[model samples]
Target: MIEGTDNVSREAAAEAAASSNAATILPGATIGILGGGQLGRMLANAGSAMGYRFVALDPTPDAPMGQVADQIVAAYNDRDAARELAARSDVITYEFENVDADVAAMLMSESYVPQGSELLYTTQHRLREKRAIEAAGVQVAPYSEISSVEELREAVERFGTPCVLKTATGGYDGKGQWVIRDSSESDEAFATLSKAGTQLVLEQFIDFAMEISVIAARSSKGEIKAFPPAENIHVENILHLSIVPARLEDSVLREAERLAIRLAEGLGVVGLIAVEMFVTRDGELYVNELAPRPHNSGHYTMEACRTSQFEQHVRAVCGLPLGDTALLSPVVMVNVLGQHVEPLLERLAVRDEAAERLNVAPKVHLYGKKDAVYKRKMGHVNVLAESTEAALDWINETKIWKV
Candidate 1:
């Protein structure tokens, strides 16, 4: 579904990352990953297939990954626990970026963590990430750092109303953010958000035509491969659905791929990097945010692409040959929030009748989260069909939970 004249060919991308002396990690190596959420769980599943074992360091006991891989039950910042995990692992990678990057650097002196801490440090902070992106010669939304209410007010005045104020660290899924649609809301927004003492960044709101994401991987050998852009839809700041082969013009799709490649190369990311972007009505693209691991948007790749992002990530970190990123089918991926789990399971209990009624195969993925709370990502359903529209139709028909 990609269109455009300036697309980077897959062969050209592989060549750009070519290196003969690059470290080649064979199968059967134990891979240690930080954070044992669903990303770690999926990574473990993918690695296990290639004969690689996995150990995850996470604070959550009985974490999703614990169901599949060995679990080092400890906080990410626990040096002793990290040391234990590292001692048993051949090479380490991480699923979440919010963990202590300094601790990661500390571990680098003792073990082989090819994915490096530099990308984590740069991406974990909003201001720092924007600076890094701009430094790489990429475009981002007009933004300014705000330290105080006065600063927030001034930035609001300059950027105009209808801008977004986000915490510089520890915010996701619509949390730790405020939308100031009018000057009058500035004080309340700043007062409410700044109480936590985290630094903040205010960005001018772009009336984007669509939100899209490009998931790409970079191997230890410097190989780069990008999945086709995914058009994303968000509800209340949470990702609700992802449509692959994004319904974007060829030029915009090509640009998204180029930007993802640039970010992976420029950041020296050894695993996967998901670049979320905004495509304006005028067809201009702006980098919105970056995730230094497998992303929710790329979940469709599990069923729709020749290589899933999880497997590609395992290959990249293991220094194995990168897999092809070609799409196998049109797909729509819908998030299964905590609220959706009960109803979904109930529907499933009814047996083949529900599937027959839906008239489509829904590849359900339950993360095994113990509790289903509002807005928490419990799992997802990847609907594969002949067309994006059909997949989306099935998704709408099958979604029974009230989000």
Candidate 2:
């Protein structure tokens, strides 16, 4: 259950890009990366290491990804700049799934978009994603679309108590989603989104043991690799930690990987895909959702694995040989959210409570953004230990956050 290498037969790959011509995206080739966030920044860094030039597109100046790229295409004026990016780059890949699908639809006419835009289309909308997963023969949480209170009331009657109500679009990190304790709260749940004129997804609440994610990569040549399941914890809907080994039973872990690999191959997905999953109280697995790019759950690999997720993403998208996803160390990753991070540098400087308790090298990655607020993912720090328990303790007590 780890990232792929060149293992799958060529027949398993998409019909068109089966050849191994992907080895040299060539030094002079320019790679276009959509969305200039930290993930894009990391992808651009890996691209530069191979002598490839990069163009990062974003809507604002000083975007994290744009800082390191050869060409910075700011966000506004989507049509004009996208055509330009398609024209200049040999191939294009996106850092986030939220990019305008219409842009990809537009770009497909001119450039080679090996990562199918249809996957983007399906994943961008919650309804479409749930359908795709179900079509792949996977079980997803029971959900119904809601456009008004009347629809939501009917959904509550069908699905019943302890459900989550989420906006059908543009939501993450606990934003645009809420929990309705029972039928009594259905009215408020519906009113909340409906008053604001938002479409919604009312999903049955799951009584799961814990959350886990399998991060995998696939190349155009049908080669696939997967990273081990990462145990994930959330605080106020924001990701707090991702621990590897995931402390999962061998059987459950393998099943998670199987589901991920199946989804990747079934969707004809190219590049990295993170499949978020739920292990129910009965020891059964369920598909929760997906992210069509390198995920926060896989961040520990940068230092603990044989190959970084960023490198694998580039390889898969450009059709290069996949790298080994083997783990070199036990890792504990803590997300440093929002304003709490302003004091991180000072904490590390003091050798205070945080530094004194650590037993292994901790790799801290700051996204270089100055703003902070509750729930904003500003950066993450990873600590490696010999034992999973020890690793967890080190991460919990790191205190990289300021007062």
TM-score of 2: 0.91
Question: Candidate 2, which segments miss by more than 4 Å at Cα?
Answer: 1-24, 195-198, 350-358, 401-403
TM-score of each: 0.93, 0.91
**lDDT scores of the candidates, listed in order:** 0.89, 0.81
lDDT by residue for model 2 (1-403), tens:
1246433444444254444544446566888988888998888887788777888778867788877885555663388898888888898889999898888888888887778689988887778889999987888999999887788888888887878888877787777877887778888878776654556899988899999999989887778999989999887677888988898788999999999998987787889999999999776888988888999999999888998899998888787888999999989888888765766776677654543455566788878664776667888988787766776766556554423
lDDT of 1 at 222: 85
Off by over 4 Å in 1: 1-21, 351-359, 399-403
lDDT of 1 by residue, 229-343 (tens): 9999999899998988899889989989999999888777889999999999999999999999999999999988999999999999888889999999888899999788888
Which pairs of residues collide in candidate 1?
A: 3-250
Ten-residue region with minimum lDDT total, candidate 1: 1-10
